[model samples]
Target chain A: MSLESGLNQNKYLNLSSSWRYLTVENFDKITDEELVKLILENQENFLFLVRRYEEKLTRYIRRISGLDKEDIEDLLQDIFIKVYQNLNDFDTSLKFSSWIYRIAHNHAISNFRKSKARPVTVSMDEETEIARRIASGIDVLKEVDQKLKKKVVIDVLKKMDKNYKEVLILKFLEEKDYNEISDILQKPVGTIGTLINRAKKQFKKIVEKEKIDF
Target chain B: MSDLSKNVLEEIKEHHITPKPKWEFLVRDYVIWAMFGILVLIGSIAFSALIFMITNHDWDIYRNLGQSFWQFLLLSLPYFWIVLVIAFSIFAWYDLKKTRAGYRYTFTKIGLANIGLSILLGTAFFYSGIGMKIENIFADNMPFYRVIHPGRGITVWENPDKGLLVGEVTGFIDDEGFNLRDLKNQDWIVSALNSVWPREVKSNIGMIVRIIGKQTGKDTFQAIEVRPWMVNCDRNGAPAVQPCRSLDRERKPFIPFPLIPMPAK
Candidate 1:
């Protein structure tokens, strides 16, 4: 079957020859699932998915691995390629963002394993947001200015265990809820709550142990 | 417009790819969950076997081990089953993490949940007889088990210095003493004037008891301490709450004699 006619007939993309007129603005109009369905028929449509996740995944990899831009790009390319290659296998039950993040998480971990170096903190631009989430009720980091507080958070995250660090990043930095974190990490919600609690405790302990400047 | 996006786009064009098939992911998910279920089952079975070992142990056999009741208990504990339960709990924790949402939970939470789930299932297994049957099968077949198995006349009783006796309270001699029948069906007279009772003592007829003291004669002993034979006092047999060693310390030595009412001196 012709690709355009097939997509139109299947109601997958709900578009046909008119797809040629699709613009960067129109890309955001379509859902990820719909895009995946469209891409299945016309491989060129994969660029839409690529555009959607590229920058987010890039930043995610950098925050988690502290890899250089070049390495992050290489990893991002690999992750996108992986996502494209596995699009047909994507479980519809999960949110598309979560599935993509899961892929990114797995790729970053495997990359870390091969390199055998611990992840370091390289940026704190999002410090204000992270600080707000992490220091929600705790007044320990409250008096510190945004920059120092961010520095403190980064230092503590760098020193903590990988599990604690990942949960902190996902919850506070990524702003993922318990259920979304659960889906991305593939663990039960109860366990996610437990990890976040433990992660907070570990973070506090590290901050106390290191005696970071206020 | 970024060069990296352009590069990724070119790469995509050069190598046409497709997502992995849906069935492969389905198979992977199901396989992980299947493994998790199996681990939970194994953990529960191990726990049930441990419960069976403790619940069904022959307390009367400690009298034959030629050791203090506490020593015999410490030695006969089901270490093998206990280790298996711990190992299986860890495995269950790992396996559960691999499930769709397994990574979100902390290690402590997963470990505790694993144990709690296994015990829940273990209870069913224990009640259904799988736990007891496995233990019986091991005792009946394995040679090593014979060494720890509690029964009548096991060679462990060859020594006569144990000084510990467990039996039924047949009669009350006085406030400081009682008549008893040891596990071996032998008769004995006990004097507990120098002993202490950590918990309340029931001298009701047919009540089982554990006595720690010196053998004063062929059928008599100077009781250093006395306790209810089994702790938690249920109709069905349960392990003793306090064995000899702890009870030995609980006993207050050199208390004033004539614990029973007596005529004025």
Candidate 2:
């Protein structure tokens, strides 16, 4: 299996077609925390964590920031570097994935603020999928063609306030639960709930303004 | 390893970057938590002062002050320390929120923690007498504090023009009244022929009492009601409040050190 297809398939744990420092059987048993311990014990093991998170974080950054692939890679490099530097500071209480995601989230937000950029959907399929998932929360996107639905959702998302837009993407596209969203955003869970509610309202208003049912 | 991972490892080597010493992170975590604890303790001290002031305030003398109970209470509360309790709780909440896992707790959770700890430690401090000691220290050292807090007991008594006088009985005057040295050390003839003793107040030398009535002359105050200065009393006039400090509070030195000396009767 090629790396491109692995990413397209959204197989987060598929280490196939990649360099294997640890055997597949051993890697399956070892968790992210255990990987962190191994990384701390020997800095060389940090590569496993880097490889493991590379695609997932790349997609997340590109999805939230709408940065170019090269820019996303550059951001990913910096993020992993930061993760390596701060391994000692990682709280064991949090899932290691959440911790890394939080770091990535904060860095992306900081980067986006410094350079004013709008979030976007990179691919047509991802756009339609996001619109379909988002539509379930509001109203069903009835007989509208898949192409029109994607365009409408993408336009509404682009027009929404950056905060609401980011939250909606995290909830619908990234599939993070409320608690996970709170951790990533470093907001109170209650605040996240309020943000999501307002985001949905804003989304519905934009959809209505567009006035294309389904 | 992926190329980006290789580059990161290479950068790590070039920069000699290491996972910062575990002690550094540990110390950081401890410092944030220590800061939070210190803020809560300071808030508790403010709470203790609040407790001391509210407890020692003459609650039943609102009628003498010519105001309703709530009016007197509203006017007499220690707003300064109450503001401090709120301010320190926010500071404590912010400090706690700075910790790694701190954001997990909402401000309400942290605020409740701060107030609960403050109430617990504050009541303890009040009972341990630190609260009263703090009140006294502020009362004596910071005269400017007098303008801000002015104090309930002292201010209530300071309004002698409104027919209130707090002082020691210096001498007797033929059953018509007594020679009194007021809080300011001024002399006054307190005429108490038909004065009501409302609460275990005795007209004796060196007994600190609060008198209410009219100022009969420049150097005299006609007493309508006499009450003990410090101790709150039930109908029987026994010591009826907890953390009362001293059963002899009325006779002991108050507001300042060592009882004022008057010529023995």
Candidate 3:
């Protein structure tokens, strides 16, 4: 089917690839680089690309922004629109995921600042994983109560500076490496390591100050 | 399909949002690099001017200035231009950070790179005479700049009591003396009778002549020796009649400046 007709077909989350030259592999199997190339050839292929990142980006935005579901969804809509408009600006040298995450991080931060939403909380589902991840980095003994660790992690994250918290979240929760975090934040890799170290130190300071016995 | 993704696609079709043209991003990237390069060029010009000022200064006159050699050297260094070179290098280094992969380089690395390029290009500028041209432009156009940027001749010729006076011969006051305006804009009556005048130097209306004689009065000077206003005099308060080591060095008490020649009037 022609791409224009597919747009009229109301397929949003599950967009089918209609490019004549692309192999009939499932869209999930195609690298983001190839997908970007296809999208450049035909704008209709953007929907399939968007479907790949929609849920992940939504979760990322929610983790950082603490905005309500509706606000997060609305912000996602704008963010995707921006992505579509700047597809040509995407540098192929960067992993598409890192570039997209960078865009999402910047947009979320600016909107968070403008709306005056000082959101220091991650969403509910990410809480347990975040606690476990941060605790491992800080060497909090496995014997420590999981519930107590979660409380300490959340409280410490909330009190830390936005810069430190953002690096920590990207490093521990998102599982981004130093280079990926550097690309996403537009900082040197060396600086990323320093920031992560400083963030961990801040976490230790907060837990110590509160006398949390983890 | 989730509703949010559906809405985004619907809006994409409704508003027809297309990826911006590749040329636009390319232009933006090139503009950033171009700005970085231009800033470095300007910084080099400032550095070259600094090089010219420092190297062209007559370090030989320290004894006449009644200061130690180190004190004279330190006092004559061009502090204003030094600050400008530093400021421009910083601006250029910051501009480089805006480039696509500029962040990969450390501050010390990038800073040293910018400074190194500036020095290399600045030394070239010093030779091509662009440095002196820029200095003269500032000297002629900006009165305030000229005040802070004392003429090179002013230092060597300021101590009239030490038999040093330099200025433009404004007009002749008959064969015995002439009207003069020194580099500091001070007026003087220059007496050339019983003074030594070089063969090539004429009593021109606007010639910048140097007089090595005692200051006889507040606005009068006796010329023991009169030579062209030159910048590269050697340490004994001597002037080089020409950069080529003029054939007249055999003349008694004659000293020669080297490496630079005064621009012919």
Candidate 4:
């Protein structure tokens, strides 16, 4: 059967009454390796795997999503579809989570490029102080309303380059390490470090230009 | 760092986009499949190796090959892998910089293929080298030795036992004498006394010692040479044994003797 037809047939089989009994509990006891084997044996059961990592996957997606809600959803859906199609080719030696995150990062960056958004530059000096203030839980936020402050940050991020934006989002929002971001971006650890440093600077510049009350 | 810039961090966290359900599902599925493939690949390799060893009565060949493979690996494996990764990264970076039209299509295909080929070749080379070492080197006589004492901290030749100092136990020397098993875990400190030693000394010791060949006695304590350990010095004035200073005055001083480079270096 054609690949598309095979997928449709598999999905139908998955939704059939016979498959309804295949619950999360059934696979919970199995090791990841064994669970994968089961999924390979029955492609229809792949949906369970989807449910398992949904929270983490969503968090990752959220980090790269732009300000536009619809665009974010569309990009996320596209990433998932790609993941579904590539399931059979997945390598099990690597952590299943990291591999998926890599895909998500790639997809998000690609979507960002297609949208052709202008690169945003935020001042490093200002952003660093802002970052410190946020980290220190100081009175900086007291001056500006929380919602308005958030809008300012989001607007500034939207204007930044996808590279900078992704790193900032992953680091600040998702709280991923430099190493994790490096893996996701497939960039060297050193390069990621430098990018993060520069990203913060650019972010600061943008924040200053906007003159959002800190 | 200013207070305003720091506030941006909190703002970013508060304004995180809500991930769509469909995308979340897709990401999860991809992860599962990727993990499955990797596990299968590793399992297949290990299984094949095991089967090959069991079927072949001549296990000696495998042993020798493994030794040679390990030697080469120790000498060059880390450097090789690092170079390969750096080279690939450079290529990827250049490709990305030169093209604006999403080189992902070509880049991913070529990059994956290159990586796959490199891994396959590396594994083949490793196994083949192991086989060669087993057949040639391992089959021959394997010299062993003992370490009388492991020096305190990083200090070389701190306490020397006055006695005959044998061939320096190279590679890894534990607190006890050089045992064959120690080779498994630690790299040895080369002997400082025997400058003429042929095979590489791979163990560390408290003092220089004259190896009287393998000790047959039951007692673990054996007497060996101690102080005034042969300190081999290079043109740079750095001693081969303990407390060797570098020719460049700016560089930090090192201990002389024992032929082992300082770990801090």
Candidate 5:
């Protein structure tokens, strides 16, 4: 499938009915206290809480390790299981989002360590190779299309340090606020600002070395 | 295409690289949400049950179950919040990853957010649990029981004219007799005469004997009644009876013995 088509599919699938509902509702209206009380009073509604934060959490994890969908899904499951098992101790004083995000961070770090120890083949490479083969077999005129150029862009991004890549994605793609970024990373606001600055500079340098334009 | 322009286009493309999922994204999200719902349900039921047990004090099955429940709640509450925080944080990280946000950006944001959330939530749960425990403790109405003396036996006495006094041995009370000189300045002797009896001993010794028509003054010491402070005498020693520690040193040394009815003069 074309890269455009693939992204379209992802967008369609990720923006499920539940997600749409969450996105439409202003999350600020529902206080953390209310959410916690709901969890305590009716556990079933806790799913809403999970859904509320899942996308952001998943995005955070994916950026850190560059793990594919399967690994990310498995890790996400493990994290929830842990949260489920220990929900009784959740302190109502804290923001519910912050608590869950902390869990995500630790689990991601641990998962990264494990992934480093037990290396897995990059499935994206395989997919790209297959795409290349398919494209080579197609009409010669179409083989040198813009789609192929996009693939090359993806390939270069894959080679960048995971840290630099994450900053770019969150800033340009996710459009998250600096405060939100700071909260997710457990860093001071100043530190996040600094990291973003450094990341942009490093990214620019990398592209320049590759003789690529801004 | 000019080399410079081509390079520029390539860089922009690289910067805009998007994530491609390997699985059906809808199904994954559904499964996660479903699982979360189930977990919350189970947790709520368990939490309610715990609250019920604590509030009702339905520990008839085992006499000590009530105490055990409080202990378990105290020990487990902190750990529960911590685990929840960690798990949710991981979930956030995974979400960030799937979106292909850069590692530094995603992790920094998610990590800080999660930690803050966990601490806030955990603290709230802990305080609530603690509050419940305090309420339970008071509700039990077990009586503020304390042992004034632990080991050597103490004899409680009441002089009707005075109030109440407890006497514990200095040196061992030999079969022959207690040596007055050796007992004079001993800690036990000094402590016993002065200290307030355990809270369990509500009535002064004089009152107990007075009801029996015991004479006051001379018969005061003999009229006094003494008992072990703790329920399980075999396990815990008698509570030490000492003057109120907060009192002035001179005042603390002498607990006025209650006057009993005087014997026929």
Candidate 6:
């Protein structure tokens, strides 16, 4: 078959109702790398990959940027488009999830710059969980109730430098390990460790500056 | 698929923006490394020029400039080359930070590394005589260099208080003195009674020599040291006889002085 006819046949096979229950490799069992290879062969299959990431990435963009629904939608489209265009450059050794998050982080940071927004805060539920996580890590904040601690942490994060604040968000809100944070920030794991420690110190200092009786 | 996914996929289909070619990144990396290499080369040249100027300066000949040792150094030091070294080092620091793995190091670390590397390579270049050749090129080409470098030029020896004089030996008066014609062709009796000659120099008639001593008479000088008046020679071993106006030529003060008759004679 000519290349166009072959592509059309693949499209036909993909759209047929039999594809949902087909004997081919299952979507759940296939690795993201394998999915990427399949997508390269037929661009229409990229929708499956996009659907997998859309909800998680949408929430991630919202939490990191605090942009409105429309802006988040626009950024989500841009990030996915960027992911598609640069799919060839992805390193197979890294987890594809980390690479996607890295792209998202970069795009959101750029959006923040464009909008001239300084504050990146988590939702209340996320803040409460992150505050609990911080309390578990640092003993001093452990005594406070989850709500009060979350409020204090949010206040402190709002006032901190972007470098420190981002590490805190990645560590507590996103619950990412040092290596994943390193990949996202393009820094060494040791630097991520240092940044987290420094961020904790700055968090405490900001808490003190605000005269919070923690 | 969700509407968001469908819309994004449709946009990708319409725009068809592909990843940049791998060669573009390779080209970028090559250009960055090339820039770094050029900076290092320029920095090496600047640093070696600095080392050459320092080592080749006549530290022992301060009396010829009518100044104390420190004063002569302050006046004649090659500040231009030193400034060039600093500028190149800064450029190296800025350029190096843009390289892969360069941002991992602190700015001070990068700056110090640049200086340390330059100095190490500069030492090698110094030993290889690239530094000396570069300094010589500047000294020979830039006439104004003597104005900034005080210890250069025959004018330094003209100060009677400095106990330095350049003259051609017209005839030996005796074991203690000689009738000499200064560069300006003025006749003077040079008293070499207590003069020291580190090397045995043939005091042939018509030979030019520099006498470092004090003036004790209207037409006489008391010599403390006597040395041959060396003219700079070119790569072909031929004398590069600079015109009298050229003040920045670098020459050893101890080479054999050729027997050239005084111009006025």
When only the first chain is scored, the TM-scores of the models are: 0.82, 0.81, 0.86, 0.63, 0.59, 0.81
Root-mean-square deviation per candidate:
12.3, 7.6, 9.5, 21.0, 20.9, 8.3
Candidate 1, chain B, TM-score (2 decimals): 0.54
TM-score-superior candidate, 1 or 2? 2
What tens digits encode model 2's per-residue C-alpha lDDT throughout B1-265?
Answer: 4677777767876787888878999899999999988998888888998987887677777886679999987888898889989999889888988988778788888788878998999889877777767876675566566666655456468678888888776777776777788766898988888988642445345556678888988988889877665544222335544333322333333333234565565
Q: Please give the DockQ score of every candidate, comma-separated.
A: 0.34, 0.41, 0.49, 0.02, 0.02, 0.32
Angstrom error of the Cα, residue B236, model 5: value is 52
Report the lDDT tens digits of candidate 4 across residue range A5-114: 44345542332323443344454544444445555556434445555655566556555552344544455555655565565545564456656788977776566578
- For all candidates in order, the CA lDDT equals 0.70, 0.74, 0.76, 0.43, 0.41, 0.69
lDDT of 5 by residue, A6-53 (tens): 333333222222343112134334555565444444333344455555
Q: Please, what are the lDDT tens digits per residue for candidate 6 over residues B46-96?
A: 788787667544567786665798887787678978888888888888888
State the iRMSD of every prediction, in order shown.
4.4, 4.2, 2.3, 16.1, 18.0, 4.5
Which stretches in model 6 have alpha-carbon errors above 4 Å? A1-60, A87-102, A142-149, A176-183, A186-194, B59-77, B132-160, B164-265
TM-score attained by model 6:
0.70
The full ranking of all candidates by DockQ, starting with the best, is 3, 2, 1, 6, 5, 4
True contacts kept of 4: 0.00
Where is model 4 more than 4 Å wrong at Cα?
A: A1-22, A26-34, A67-74, A114-148, A208-211, B1-265
Predicted candidate 6, C-alpha RMSD? 8.3
Q: What's the distance in Å from true for residue B118, model 3? A: 1.3
| Candidate 1 residue lDDT tens string, B1-265 | 5666666667876775556678888899899888888988988988887887776455655654556888877877888788888898888788887776567667888788888899999988877767765765665555455454432222232222566666777887667777887646788887877687533454465666666667888888776667664334433333332221122221212223335555555
Ten consecutive residues with minimal summed lDDT in candidate 3 chain B? B246-255
Model 3, B140-242: lDDT tens per residue?
Answer: 5555555566566455676788877777767887778788887567899988887887643444566566677788998888887777654332223344322
TM-score versus the correct structure, for each prediction: 0.62, 0.79, 0.76, 0.36, 0.32, 0.70
Q: Which number leads on lDDT? A: 3
